[model samples]
Target: MKLSDLAESQILKAQAEGQFDKLKGAGKPLNLTADGGSAEAIGFRIMAEAGAVPREIDLQKAVQEQALVLKETEGEDARKRELKKLADLQMRLEMEREARRRFFGE
Candidate 1:
């Protein structure tokens, strides 16, 4: 038999055996962003959900957390510090995103 036919046969056998049932997000729509960029976004989203995000995505997450903290901060001095930290993290995240875009020609 041809290789493609063999593969299809195996897939059909697995399906009949219910080996693909009850998988995560089985009935849910994919959470893809509207950016319509490279498939890396989907990959990154999956990794992020598993707490294994890449450095750039991790930095972006940190920036978001810091922004929330800054909003809740009360003291002027503390808020200023949080703002500075948030700015630094945002800059780093932006740089990493640009580098990836250029490298992937996205």
Candidate 2:
């Protein structure tokens, strides 16, 4: 094989073997509190700005229907609110995944 092909194969092999796993950006050990909001809030804000959610509710009804239902013991009202939020998030995630698939023609 050519040198380029050999190098590519070695890189792929190392990736498959998890040799590069430690290089992943797992972030700092310290919980730096310089930011005003939580990391999760920042991430969600980015996702929202990127138009991750479907514009129409009908387009996401199928995904929302499959969202997990919280137990009754968790307090019906609170559970209901959480479940609704989870369903909305799930539907948005599903829409984003579909958009990515279409973009990549996967």
Candidate 3:
């Protein structure tokens, strides 16, 4: 059989086996905003729901977490390391944000 046919058969078999029966938000409406944004917004929502955020967003999250840890840290060396990490994440996030803004003119 052709490759597409084989892929379809595999997907059908998985469905028959209930492999996708208990996914998160399985029966809930998607939490998309009603602002009628671009298709890119829809794709971003889907990717976020799947825990696949863009690098800038991910870096921002990391920076937040690192800030929390830095606050709780007590040792001098550890604090320095955490500070360096936070700075690096912040720089990367800035770069990614600028790139996205340039590409999308946003």
Candidate 4:
């Protein structure tokens, strides 16, 4: 059978069994405005619901923290190390943005 046919049959069976009777928002109107039904928005919404963040976002945070560390470094050696680390994080963030732009055409 076709995928849609199978899906419809499953839904009908569940409805017959009253399996969806108590589902949350069962009779409520859908809130499609929240994500606008885009793949990126839907992915972000699901990630946020699961307490997760995108890799680029995490990398940006790391870059900020590294900057702070670089600023606080006292010795020349430590300063150089921290500056390198900060540069690396920033480069990684840029690469991530480029990759996403190429792959998702975002």
* Model 1 segments more than 4 A misplaced: 1-38, 45-52
lDDT per residue for candidate 2 within 1-106, as digits (tens), equals 9766897998799789986566423344423353345664444443454455434333455445545344433787887787787677677767776775675477
lDDT against the true structure, per candidate, is 0.80, 0.58, 0.80, 0.82
lDDT of 4 at 60: 88
**lDDT tens per residue, model 4, 26-104:** 6886566777967677666655655668898799889999988888889999999999999899999999989988876
Off by over 4 Å in 2: 1-73
RMSD vs true structure, all candidates: 8.9, 15.0, 7.1, 7.6
Candidate no. 1 TM-score: 0.56
Displacement of residue 79 (Cα, Å) in model 4 is 0.6
Error (Å) of candidate 4 at residue 83 is 0.3
Candidate 3 has what TM-score?
0.58
The per-residue C-alpha lDDT of model 1 at residue 34 equals: 47
- The total number of steric clashes, by the backbone 3 Å criterion, in model 3 comes to 0
**What does candidate 3's lDDT look like per residue over 1-106, in tens digits?**
9766896998799789986577566678655665256566765665686676988778888999999999999999999999999899899999998998877678
User: In model 1, what is the error at residue 43, expressed in angstroms?
Assistant: 2.6
The 10-residue segment of model 3 with minimum total lDDT is 30-39
**How many residue-pair clashes does candidate 1 contain?**
0
